[model samples]
Target: MNRRDFLKLSGLTAASLALTTLRPRALQSPTRKLNFVILLADTMTAANLSLYGYPRRTTPHLERLAGRAIVYHSHYSGGNYTTPGTASLLTGSLPWTHRAINLGGLVRRQLADRNIFHLLGSNYHRVGFAQNLWADLFLRQFRADLDTHIPSPTFIHGQEKPLVSQFFKNDELGAYYALDDFLLSTHHVVNPTAGSASMGYLGLFYGLSNRDIGTADAEHPYGLPSNGYYFFKNSVLYDGICDTILDLHRRENPFFAYFHLMAPHSTYRPTRQFVDTLVEMEFPTKQFHPLGGRTNRRTLLEQRKVYDEYVANVDAEMGRLFDSLDAAGVLEDTYFIITSDHGEFFERGEYGHDTPLLYNPVIHIPLLVFAPGQSQRVDVHTPTSSADVLPTLLSLAGKDVPNGEGRPLPGLGGSEDGARPIFSVEAKQVSSFIPLSRTSISMVKGTKKLIHYRGYEKYPDAFELYDLQTDDEEKRDLYAEDTVTAERMKEELFDHLADAEKTLKK
Candidate 1:
């Protein structure tokens, strides 16, 4: 660990002991009006952050903030990308249960109402905003629960509505996703989706205006390289989040606010000051596997350099946000949660999170919970999932957690439920509902992880096993070497899938 992180963790460890010794009610009152906020930073990978033992200082702000929060070192997302990952966080169910396994898909209609926003009930005012168009689909799916529903691209790029309206007018239409399938797939339309046409226009606009996806200038501002429907810069998005927090603070009752910010995701546009500083750092070269991945070594290293710069920029912005929350006195009375929808990959012949491969970098995300009156930091090293976030928050809010695959998070009054098995499934290439076809599934129990690939034309069902404790990089595969262990895990994984199918049959 870096000196700064070492000092912070030491201080937190001392504080945690004191807080735990005191009376439980002394921390915060359950009867008092409490607030909840999920600051979802898109694709902020745990593997890259210094807090998780990376040599580079990618998350100094979060590292300091960890002194007063609950940090989960082994947190995994439900899927490799925005759609299923964010859906799992929202609905407290895995991709298989939620059936939002495809890119830019919505939660299954049957499970839509059970979303956290709706389950929190009518007691607190609920608000939602997502800069990523794909994540906004799930929020739109649960629109009935939100008391204040802001436009997905509002307050971004300055004149967000007017600029985006050139392609994304009528915000309430959800960018006409149903119609999008028609236009993007077959150019036929009965009731044409307005947003589909806008997509082409917006793409052209971004192409013309955003010639440099990796440029940040004073004139352009906000590092906004593109004005497309799906992306935003952290510089701009963080400002809007602070403004929204200020607005929500004045409401009569407590509120449950969800802000899923898209930054540190792609294009990797950090400011001029951040670029080229960490360009020479050496990282481990990943060993190739048979599952299939292709990217040049130079390109992967370059992407990692830019991605680290972007993460630094986001860290600075988050520091400003923490100051604002502290000044506004929200820190002492809010259940503030910080996490990511998914993580990015810069190794094993992959740069971004387009996953046919379920490597650690693409699935492991950072999860920090800062409960009100939490004076000392407590770290939870147990493997956890994005799906558990909903149930955990519900338990804190004094609400009955609905019937879902995830239970209450550990280290927060939740005990082990028999032999807990954490699962993450990726099936963007195939049907959302039937994920086993053309898919990759990750099953984690203790330190051992099993990656299963199924229903591929070239590569049929196969498996790769890694003991994370010994092989964090996942360079060595032990599937053939350890038959007994591999077979046991495979049987357990199949049993879990069978249960998910049974639920679908219902």
Candidate 2:
């Protein structure tokens, strides 16, 4: 069946079914409040942005918007990985409580039935648009709370060529034809995994990397080629998502649109135009860290340049999205939030996320909230996790913030003095014998932070403490030296964990 036919067969066409199954009954209420637009960048580091004083012109649009929004300098994600961080953002609960640590996990089953989407659905229209495979995973969970969920186009038409065609030059076209036949007939293909099983399938076309059907060429297919930099300049994910936001702005109703951008992540490709701009800027290359080693200062500097350029590209696209919102006259009524699931580490031995080291580079993300009629900039020094996002957004919409582990943020007029202990958990995976096993749990109260390793056999685990008043980067380890401070922090952390367990049991 074609895409439309498949959607029809899936019972997605019935408005009543979609509304009843996808949304909460509270959304049917007559109150119309603030609309929400959450723009999430995958694997983005706040330190890379010019607005955050990265020494590069990375986020011109964001810098401009920061003047009119509240920029939280110390905002951290609840977890170090995508699924857990995103789960925390959506449910306002730590990963340990939400239990959505991996790719296939579902948030709806584990957490309380109260989500920002579910709470706002009672009064506003909820929609989502995601570009990355991980974002798609969250979208699947979000579908349970949204009034309308729009699946992003897997591939862009003019921007990206078929992956199969790019890899296999001579017979690439023919190969795609053969792969298409296999996909249509068998509904299952081994070479290039079909549907959403593989990352390649999540692109614009399903047959982008089918080797059996396409012709082989000199270029590498499985890995990114050296000349792969060209594709970043010409890629379509940014513009395509911008167009979606524009269309949603024109529709009637207070809407919640969650847009996820895949750029500035990995396979780090900044458009040639952006790269050229960086070159002209004459950024210091002495600090580039291509290999991600501690001593590769030159490589680190160069990688930062590349990361900044990619962020600039995203910023330009965001300018277009913001302009569209302003033109649609929804800018004032919208509660806009821009953040990331996690940050990337340039090869520093940390190529991607989920590192053993919980460094600030991986967890410290940019968080900016622009609520209607709120103009003053408020710096929230208190430690805030991604888990607080949902509750804060719900409260801003004049809805009762759901009862969850996350408390409403103080600066948004929802709560005051965010003094409660905040915790973050990371679960690498689960074993068959133990159902809900996790990797590590990190808790922060006041200035102290503790990380407990549960999945590993290591006893006493590990812990790190940072007095935010003095050390923000968390460079010095005070665990061993400051016994009294460490013990007090550990007690606070355990108390919060025990309380959460009791709440779950009840």
Clashing residue pairs in candidate 1 (N, C-alpha, C atoms within 3 angstroms): none
lDDT of 1 at 84: 90
RMSD of each: 4.6, 12.9
Off by over 4 Å in 1: 1-28, 158-175, 178-227, 230-233, 416-418
How far residue 450's Cα lies from its native spot in candidate 1, in Å, is 0.6
TM-score of each: 0.88, 0.73
lDDT of 2 by residue, 165-244 (tens): 22333443243334422232223322334433343345435335432332322331322211111132223555565566
lDDT of 2: 0.60
